[model samples]
Target: MTLTLAIVGRPNVGKSTLFNRLVGKRLALVDDQPGVTRDLREGEARLGDLRFTVIDTAGLEEATDESLEGRMRKLTERAVDMADVCLFIVDARTGLAPADRVFAEILRRRASHVILAANKAEGAAADAGVIEAWELGLGEPLRISAEHGEGMTDLYAALMPFADAAEAKTAETAPVTDVAVDEDGEAPALPGNDKPLQVAVVGRPNAGKSTLINKILGEDRLLTGPEAGITRDAISLQIDWAGTPMRIFDTAGMRKKAKVQEKLEKMSVSDGLRAVKFAEVVVVLLDAAIPFEQQDLRIADLAEREGRAVVVAINKWDLEDEKSVKLKALREAFEHLLPQLRGAPLVTVSAKTGRGLDRLQAAILKAHDVWNRRVSTARLNRWLTGMVEAHPPPAPQGKRIKLRYMTQAKTRPPGFVVMCSHPEKMPESYNRYLVNGLREAFDMPGTPIRLTLRSQSDKNPYKGRKKPGPSKLRKHLK
Candidate 1:
């Protein structure tokens, strides 16, 4: 157990900038806009020789009700309570405001260890603001610039005492028992399987991605409400999801490109896309009322294009009035709208009531398995032989495109390469036939399959050479 530092302050006070400085990565999205960060995102931070866990919290607002701002404030307070130390930041450029004092008072009462810091105090213009931060009554403000990496040594000096105490406490505590355990609760993970699977939940705004994850966690680990796009960061949480060790990333609601005009929203969407690229499996949560909207279709296609295993989950199923008709309609729409994910699992779940989660979990596991499914070359060639015999490749200009051989090149969204004559001339329809046939024959439905065509003549020794002149051939023989 290491020390935890929570960075808290009002909106646009550079808390996220300081967090990125400490973590040495742009894990948290930062922008000029206020309240860009809405969730408590944690990262492993390193400053000087010290290493600790750092949490970047939402901007504190003067609200305690169930509104978005109020919920954000509560979430920040939770971070302050759990953290070993709280670093309260104030905007030096703007000077101290009433909200700063208000939050400072809350920190003084709640946080056992609080470090007062005035961020963006880099220039002479901020000197007055730095002096003003002392009026918050926490202590003398440490002047630091999170963006330019100024005054980090002072911040490090202030945190050393708490780090020492946390180290002593960790040495006395019992060891953690969060190891991998099967249903029997004794088996260990296989070699090369130490890390949990990476899964990302993504969809349109207000699709209940955060709610669905909270239901899966059985806790309010993520902030959720009636507001759309409440989540702004792609927050990753590790959990033993139904005996499967997995790291689930809850991404910000992604809107269509034209409507995503704000710079902050663009960064948030980019962060979500990066999560999709890193994930092994993606769960596209859809609203039951509008299961396959155009944006939803695009998101699903994006996941497929990234070669990630996808499971379509229709959230809020409890509100639906016609289950049978709706399910049938959804299934039909799913197939018709997204032909690439034709056989992918479409499970209905109510994130509000935690219904159909068991089925969702089963679907996720099944999709992951299919994504990693591999077929032996012998079996694949055998299947290819039959596929070709049934419907031979088209001959354009009397040139029969013979698929001479086929082999599985990789798994985890299966990829294959076919050695054939006139591979470039191979029509898209024939490639689709092979891809579909491989999916059905190898039980790899719904997962993206990569099929590459290459002419076998490229491997021939004489293929690329001009017909050697007779004299050149004689010289070579000599």
Candidate 2:
């Protein structure tokens, strides 16, 4: 059983900061601005030896209607309802405000378990506020500073009882297995077996990356707002999609190098790039209204270069008019701009409205399968023979280069090695031809295909040596 803790408070009370602290990563975007977080973001959190799910929610406001703030408050209340325990935080520097009091009363009435925390309690200025927090009547508040990493031991102590209860319940309900089972009882593990697929969603700023992930999850699992660059760190969440277990990473939007001027933005871009490298399949989400921007092409090309399977998702299809014409134009632009991913699946989805999500999921699974595809050595060699016969290697120096052999060196990007007469002299165009041939022949479209050429001479020991007629002394004696 996984325990869940929701950090709820008024605006700018360090809820996201505490979330980042507990998760041991900067997953939530933190700034001095209030209401920077408008959605509920959940992460696996750890404090000392206790591990549980932590949720960072938007600030609790007094609104209760259809306005944005009202919607945000409703979302926070939903999180409070779903959580096993609510860590209600108050600003120790500013003391307890009327809004905090209101929310504290709301939690008192709603939540079964509540732990009041006085954040920013590291300085002498917070002493008065820390004392004031007791007036809220939610028990003794734990004094802590989320930014400086203070008072976690007390927080851990406060959370141990809940953790223990969860663990006990889990142990009680867990199915028992026989320790001394038959040797043949265990199932065999095969290569290319069922493993969780790693998919990374990457795109330019405000391309609805987080929105798409949230729609796929069917919950507000990541913070989404009108603000661009709302997502900073690359956050990963495990989910089951149509019986397929997948680990999806929602990454920060990558802008052009010239536009990425701030240090924090640079770090965000670097984190996004790392996620793409670690992922098996990368979904390059593009804004449907602004289909193929320069940055979009760059991001797609980067994923291709990283050897991850590429899937293009045109987001915000709900907002696009004349769907047929727009989709045709988008496809033409995709093919023209990104020839490397020519046949990759181009899915149109409205992440906000949850439209076309089924197709997106299917496309992702297909791309993952293609990424893990492996061709047999015999088939690869036969294909290589045909390719050589169809279009022979270019003779740079009036000497026809002999293509000797071919075999699949590896999979997971489908790497192949070709032993030939002058690998260093092979033209770039010829290499492209072979790669294109492999893609078309094996039906490996959009997935990265690695074809390496090796000089056969490098593998031969006496390729350039002249053999004497036996040993000179033995020949003379005979």
Top TM-score model: 1
Clashing pairs in 2: none
Question: Residues 191-221, candidate 1, lDDT per residue (tens digit)?
Answer: 4246888899999999999999999999888
Model 1 clash pairs are none
Lowest-scoring 10 consecutive residues by lDDT in candidate 2?
186-195
- The candidate scoring highest on lDDT is 1
